[model samples]
Target: MADPKPALVLHLATGGEPLLFALTTEESGKLAGKLTQLVKAGAVETVTTKDHQEVAINFAHVAAAYLDDLTRKTTVFGMR
Candidate 1:
């Protein structure tokens, strides 16, 4: 087996379920950049989720964002 691919997760300051986007790393980075710009400009934008749901995101309320990789298994002392 191999490690799973990463996903982009966004959380709002209002406190609710985190939004997870199953996008490629490049796509994730691009979205993140867009959010940053929106936040700086104090704007709101709509984005589609993995389930094809349209979500309106208020950048001002975005508490934090990050790329999450489930986990990476490593060995210690040359053992699995």
Candidate 2:
């Protein structure tokens, strides 16, 4: 059988650049809850973007991180 995991999209603070990766739904939930703690706990050292760009994660940078929900629905007039 094929992998049933869904993609969890990460939107970087840098110019709203989006990074896509596959993660199990369970991991996604854990990530959602641990995002702030993970940032504050000094566990993560660096973040790698999809474009092969690397970013250093510091207290100040992670302080700006937050969970957000995005949708791509079309309307009668146009895209919102």
Candidate 3:
């Protein structure tokens, strides 16, 4: 079989400086495109895993960031 798809997680800093982002392996590009779109829209900063298997878009400045983090946390881990 082909290499397994890498997981992913997106973390956006909230209530603090030096913005933060946490991502896991299950939340890859294909899984988190909508968030990526938001990143592209200038709503957040996007940070993909080294292998491109995961993606984390920072949206602390946006209200939705907190919501997204909560939803995604149940699915993806904070780290690999």
Candidate 4:
């Protein structure tokens, strides 16, 4: 069997840049921590639960401001 792909939420900025984040099965505390760090570093706009299987992180706060980086990382993780 193949490894299960992680679910993701893609956050976008007004300029259309994306900030991809992996969805966790457990509580979002860890993810939240990482997001907080990212936000402090200006690497994300906001982090919020979109649904049971989704977490959104806006890209306005991203320092790199590149959706391609998010795409690359997501592809590597087998997330579409």
Candidate 5:
């Protein structure tokens, strides 16, 4: 078997503040590209998570990010 693709998460931040999302790598890349384009075109005013916390976007005062190597493992509920 080939090496598995690295897991990813998207982190949205403004002025060093952050909000995180456990999205798949593909989803993370696509959203990052979309955000960049929208930021360039001034199409995105606000970004939010499933929980509805807003992410403030600023092209000049913003940073890009992604989290990788976040592996998953199976667990049983009453097992220590």
Candidate 6:
């Protein structure tokens, strides 16, 4: 089966550069909730990407967070 994981897109308040993190839908949802809480608490957190890169993000600067529905490849079974 092909990978169907969508990317978590974080739009910064700066309005120009957006951060992309490859994650499953469920993980993205959970992360979104955590981000919301952190934003309310005014915290800066570090998140590890799928590639194992650590990124420090200030919740206050996060304008928006959503999952990017990337194109998926259809997998055919019982076919060469």
Candidate lDDT (C-alpha), each: 0.63, 0.46, 0.41, 0.40, 0.44, 0.66
Estimate, for each residue in 8-32, the C-alpha lDDT of model 3 and write its tens digit.
3333335343333334445444346
Model 5, CA-based lDDT: 0.44
Error of 2 at 78 (Å): 19
How much is 45 displaced in model 3, in angstroms? 1.8
CA-RMSD of model 5: 10.1
Cα lDDT of model 2 by residue, 38-79, tens digit:
556745544443344555545333324443323333223212
In candidate 2 the C-alpha lDDT for residue 74 amounts to 29
Model 6, span 27-48: residue lDDT tens: 6666766766776665787776
Alpha-carbon runs more than 4 Å astray in model 2: 1-6, 39-80
Ranking by lDDT: 6, 1, 2, 5, 3, 4
For every model shown, what is its TM-score relative to the native structure?
Answer: 0.52, 0.37, 0.24, 0.27, 0.33, 0.61
What would the per-residue lDDT of candidate 5 be over residues 1-80, giving only the tens digit for each residue?
A: 54333432333444444434444455445566566555455453454433545555444433443434334354232332
Residue 59, model 2: Cα distance from true site in angstroms = 9.0
Model 2 RMSD, rounded to 1 decimal = 7.6
What's the candidate order when arranged by decreasing TM-score? 6, 1, 2, 5, 4, 3
Residue pairs clashing in model 4 are none
Off by over 4 Å in 4: 1-14, 17-22, 43-80
Clashing pairs in 1: none
Model 3 TM-score (2 dp): 0.24
